[model samples]
Target chain A: MMPAAVAEPMNTGTPLDKDASQADLLRSARFRMEREAHWRRLDALVTRAEKGGIISLSYDETRDLVEQYRQAMNSLSVARDISLDRALVAYLESLCSRAYLVVYAPQESLGGLMGRLLTRGIPQAVRRSALPLFIGFLALLLGMAAGYRLFIEDASWFYTFVPPDLADMRTPEASANYLRSTIYGDERHEGSRLAAFSSSLFSHNTRIAILIFALGIFLAVPSFVLTFYNGLVLGAFFGMFAQKGLGYDLFAWLSIHGVTELAAIAIACAGGARLGLAILLPGRRTRRAALRHEAHDAVKLVILAGLMLIAAAFIEGFLRQLVQSPILRLTIGWGMGLFWLGWLLFSGREKKIRRGRS
Target chain B: MTKKRTRKSGPRIEQFVPPEGVPVNFTIATLGSRLGAQLLDLIITYLIVFICAAGLFYGGMLPVEAETVLIVLLAFLFRIPYYIISELVWNGRTLGKRIAGIRVININGRRLTPHQVTARNLMKEVEFFTPLTMVFAAAAMSNWGIALLLAWVLAITIVPLANRRRQRLGDMVAGTLVVNNPRSVLLPDLVVASAASVPEAEMFDFLPEHLDIYGTYELQTLEEVLRDPARRAVTAEIESIARAIVRKIGYTDPVKSGQELAFLSAFYKAQREHLEKLRLFGTRREDKFHHAEGANADTAADPVKS
Candidate 1:
């Protein structure tokens, strides 16, 4: 028995007859318009074929051409030898031609491209690394608690060995002087090369922080270790400073930039951890495939972290050293830190409300 | 040139023959399969991510803050690119999906497009956070209960129940479907063979504009079957036949995979002509076979007539 031919419903929305209304086509078109599968296939074919010389149209060009074909089909009263299906095929071919044009188009502005990357790709990357991002935040909080415990507790185990000469790592009077210099901006050091060098060093350190976050994906183990090391160093630095009565001075110096810088560090670690997980245990996928998958996710977090580092560096240079009042420094530092944490956890990028409206 | 015959007889729905001799799964059986597969995937993915993060934490390379962020970030990103690349390169089945005897494809059994993968995975939050997931979590509370429940919901609700052969919520939103792919046959990891060198269009018999009807026949048939949304097992022979016809005259450019053949057939019905020819041939051959047998039977019954 011969298989039967059934005229399935057309998704084009364009009526074969002259009397077909816009609403008629629109009803069907909604399904096709929103059909990612249809558009995606069309996009792939057009892009792939454009790699060859056969299809050479750009994205907009292809979209316009396809629209035109649909319009042409709608205008016609009778079905000529060319069926609706045939007309669609022609439009797809045109679309492919346009995609090819884009593939072969000349490379454009880096700044513009980078902007697009940040605007479009970064959010996706952030979303992908959300798991690690959350965990990393928790780790940051824990690390801070650990630092407080190690530095503030007078009877802490690390401080058990008391050397008479090491009793004063900082002096109360010297700390007060440093605090004054940080807040009032020491006129003596203004416009000096030493200030410039210090600022540069601060910037350099932040960049390194960004790189650590980015490269953590390459090797998960190292990224984790580096993050832990930073925490340890921070604990030791504060502990040593406080023992000598310079804790107030250190707070004024660190608070301005520490808020943003510390957040960036946590974010970077999250990005790195995202990549490492894909590598260490790929579930059912081979390690290579999992790694590649994880790396893309990590890259997004790294970029966001990079932005944070830049912000931190600017604050560290301009505000940290200039801010002499320890109380003021504490307020600003804690406020910024709290704001960031709140944004990261509950800002909720769902944007579903906007989606539902559309 | 062979003229393709149209199957124009009135609709006679045969008791829907299961394709490729595969059994039709009932609702219970299909749901069981989907649920089982989801659990497996969830366990595997979480374990991998947790272990890696733990190793990194212990290694001391990742700082405490970084480790916390890493955990949150990796969990979400795990399925995004996995879905995207697998759909594009591996034709929708990740290694996990392949192991579980399921794969994601277009509504019309075609290799997944990158857009489809991105769309489906992007909306993963919806599936994971769907009310159904919440209900399931309440039913299965534990430390990993929420995550495990979500994983199961994805497999159960988003995956096509074996009986319906339609879409799960994720598939519906993403415009993709999970099909049974026993052996994961991937599209060639196509290299940019002609990257700077634009190969001249090979001169074929058909011109780009002239082949307007290109894949209409195949496209129309595909659309018909897909509209019904039945999860019918496609036979290898049928796949080849459809693909060969579509490739020969569907578009000016050639398609690479059988999945592509099925895909193009939905949008372009020009290949319907070729399909008609196959139907005609099958019918004619069957008639001839019966005729010869009848003649042979007559001869045996009466030798003089022979």
Candidate 2:
């Protein structure tokens, strides 16, 4: 059966003066009758293509599809101008858009997509974002040094910088044993406790990374501030440990997972800074256009950062607590850091082949 | 062709003027609807997290450590994938957005990519979740944190209100728009029965002046009124509308009370024909008001006073 509205004739009630409306209806009815077959053919082709792939159509069917699409577009224009039927006009609009997607839109396979993202998309995006990444890292370092100096000068500065819940190890009056227990956790309940700790830490870090990335839109100030704040906390902890002569031990402990965790946060901040730079100094492109272009690379960096955070969580939870040896902890930390640096530098680079001609 | 006016207020109606055809406007979704859709999505995300946590605890598949880790990971990660996957699969519509009849669309008319979806949703963490966390988790300890969180929330909310496009920070940053999905109802053909029943003189005679007062858009609207039985139920209301139209078009003929619907129907038909005829000659009127000044210029040049 024909669709509900398309086949139905217009209800132009009898009147000689209203004969023009009747004539218009008759014209519409004739137009539909003449072109309905082509419309149906196009609809069937589109439905098949939508369900499977447009490549599934035979060569003749493909040719016919194009022909039918053009005819439908012409019919739509005519119907839109002359016919006062809203439903008919709407149907044509829907049909034309469907045909447009099938005819013009690019289709990609899942395997091809994954391959592209890994090989070219993510690495290229990261490489492009180098400037912002460096800026974010510098801001973090500045904050860390400032925080460390301030806390060392005034012990009370720790409370102002670090939230109480997160100040587990660095509290001024806490005993050495209490600080050690907070660092290594309890031996008997280590497994469960570490699990909870790492999980919470992962969530907190992920939340911060996302926030850093997002807040870059407001001229990048909040993102820079947040990254600096993260650095300040780390510095405050280091300063407090240094006073107790446990700075080296704390360094080793943090390095176990800190390499990956800190890099992830830094990468997220880089993404945010990229966005902020786009808005602040769009240069030749319009602000909107620059933002759109930058968003592509920024989003990729954020995704990579998120993946790194998961890895960090695993390392922090299980390995950091278990590996009590300072040398082993430092070795693992440096090794992982080198691996990340190497991957970022060389993972997707193209090599020139030397060919010998005989 | 009339020059387009620069919009200065309300959510931007992104006008899709096809390369060779008339402009079609898609209005950005209102804040109320967007909030409702977001609330639904948040509830769904919460439920999923709760279910997974419950499953991990009850199943006892792993030790408490592994379970705790897994649940925490799930809590942090589940919502992200939920949004990203749903939008990717459904082309910018999550289950909640689908239910609320809104969909995310790239304003530049390109298909929404996965990266765009990820960017917009990730920004939600900054715009919504981060501040929410501050308010709920850290409000008691720091008044500064509370103030900052409140300001962040207020700024994001106000951004959409102040912008012409109703774009929140996420939308602006990601360059996406949430819009009401176009819903087309199958209107029954209005010309079939009316053609056969009414006598010749019963139809109102529409002069060029009466015909010029409306275009196809208004004609279609009048057709809808005529088609709906409920609209015709109140004779007085119909008569008033009919009278208003008559006055607007400077139709001096007196309309009897019962004949208002018939007059509307007749006028709709004449206006439609006039507009279509104008279109045939390469003259297009977007609406009656769109060409009023142009029409006035033409009338002034013609030296015809009617």
Which has the greatest lDDT?
2
Q: Candidate 1: where is the Cα deviation over 4 Å?
A: A1-131, A134-187, A191-203, A342-358, B1-306
lDDT of 2 by residue, A131-157 (tens): 999978987888889989998999899
TM-score of structure candidate 2: 0.81
- Reproduced native contacts, each prediction: 0.01, 0.39
Candidate number with greatest TM-score: 2
Q: What is the TM-score of each predicted model, taking all chains together?
A: 0.35, 0.81
**Model 1 docking tier (incorrect/acceptable/medium/high):** incorrect
Candidate 2 chain A weakest ten by summed lDDT: A1-10
The parts of candidate 2 lying over 4 Å away from their true place are A1-68, A98-109, A112-115, A190-193, A351-358, B1-12, B15-25, B51-67, B135-147, B196-218, B235-267, B282-306
Interface RMSD of each: 19.9, 5.5
How accurate locally is residue B305 in candidate 2, as Cα lDDT from 0 to 100? Answer: 15
B62 Cα displacement, candidate 2 (Å): 6.7
